[model samples]
Target: MTDTNPIPARLAALKTMSGAELKKQWRALFDTEPPLFNRRYIETRLGYRIQELTHGGLKPETVRRLQDLGEQLDGGNIATRRIRTDLKPIIGTRLIREWQGTEHCVTVTRDGFEWQGRPYKSLSAIARTITGTRWNGWVFFGLKHHRRAA
Candidate 1:
């Protein structure tokens, strides 16, 4: 019987073999049965489902299949993303702004930031007067609104 744990020389020989020869040897290794599945199948199916969802109108059956497969595939991450996207608007509404020569971070209320430094009232006001966009210098996560350190 061939050793199930291949030695380094055997592994090197297998690596050097041609594709057709490798196929033959691989089948011979498993008594002529091909490998059952691989990562390619999962990637291909995911791509196909994404394409269907994006290109097609997302039929109910397809949506169900996608959800089922997603549950099996994603370890609860899919549900989390859905929840996060839903909650994104509530996040980053307020932030703790800090600047140079500040001892502590300030809470940015409607009137302006409150701290031992230069203050700003609102993030939008700050963004408008300081930067161009409403989301400038703000690192926002889901609706929980973690005001990250800048």
Candidate 2:
């Protein structure tokens, strides 16, 4: 019998194809307009799509597990979360904030954080206690700052 697997040939061809060729193949394989990402992104996604079409996509349970893990990683907001593991301060670093003229301090700890001699799982909880309002932990702690539009 002839070589049974078509995946290897199809994937190998991608390395040699031009950007235009990849876009053309993308339409054929994906049945839609190609995304506006760079050529390398297109090639990588195309490679995965090829294998996915041949072997089927990820299992539902696996997809759920990934989402759960992402929730933990994204601090429960995966829909718009960016990679932020690098932003967490080192243990023992004190995060200080001033709310309504009172200086507040939160210490980074082995298990989440500490404020006012009590343990807190997130900066948001401490913020809510301090302000009585829900807030993004990172934003509350001043780890992320957004520029306002004028």
Candidate 3:
């Protein structure tokens, strides 16, 4: 007997396909090599592709709305193309750190930082003011560190 539901049958078959076979299918479907060799990833993406081929994918308006939401979440602005979510401190957050023997506090602002009743453009400037030497403010405040060898 022949199967009627071709898409569902294809999706089911994807679960049992080998990595090389999945990569070949991925290249046919997406015109590119599969990003990884994981079985679950291949199955899930193939299922999605099968569904997309059977029924149309997301609407243009939905795509636009999603892009707009992503931009907003990334601190959307006309001037800045991209904003790093890791380094962006919410306004009114107080960052306290001990430098040398003294405790220094900085309040996060929309534009920059406020420290010791003075406004500074960058945390590194504040670090310089406090330490009297050049320092990475993110490292000084324990926000980031140098990468270690793998």
Candidate 4:
């Protein structure tokens, strides 16, 4: 069956157009010189512009609601907010502990932990190997507590 949507038909034509042609269309839609020569970028922006012109842009209330949601997710305090992973010690941090009257040192790496010049999958493995028993790596290394109130 033949599709009757002009927007889809125009977008499909955009896929086959030359870079120069896409840039020209970009200028017409955006009223400015295109930023880059990427065909996909031009096609996507142009397609959105076409649809936006046909069916008006988002309402002001909708935009305000979206911005409020973004602020809440960002913790509402941008200066003090940090990415979740930043709470952990950085790579190359050294964790030292005494197990069975012997000192064990482990170095944090980007990929995994390194102990005594040997690579280990986790601190629990090194702890088990050192103590001859199962242990929670974080607790064994004092990175976490045995239990929390919550």
Query: Where's the lowest-lDDT run of ten residues in candidate 2?
Result: 77-86
Query: For residues 52-127, could you state the per-residue lDDT of candidate 2 as single tens digits?
Result: 9989999999999998887776567543365345567898999999999999999998667899999987888999
Q: Pick the candidate with the highest lDDT.
A: 2
lDDT of 3: 0.82
Tell me how far the alpha carbon of residue 18 in candidate 2 is from the true structure, in angstroms, after superposition. 1.1
| TM-score to true structure, per model | 0.21, 0.53, 0.49, 0.45
* TM-score (C-alpha, index-matched) for candidate 1: 0.21
**Which is better, 2 or 4, measured by TM-score?**
2
Residue-level lDDT for 23 in candidate 1? 55
Q: What is the TM-score of candidate 3?
A: 0.49
Q: Alpha-carbon error at 142 in model 1, in Å? A: 22
Candidate 1 local distance difference test against the native: 0.46
- Candidate 1: list runs displaced more than 4 Å: 1-6, 35-150
Q: Model 3 segments beyond 4 Å from truth? A: 1-3, 76-150
- Tens digits of per-residue lDDT for model 3 on 46-121? 8898799789899999999998987775456643344354566888999999867889999988767899999886
Write the number of the candidate with greater lDDT, choosing between 1 and 2.
2
* 10 residues in a row with least lDDT, candidate 1: 135-144
Candidate with the greatest TM-score versus the true structure: 2
For candidate 4, the 10 contiguous residues with the lowest summed lDDT are 79-88
Candidate 2 achieves a global lDDT of: 0.87
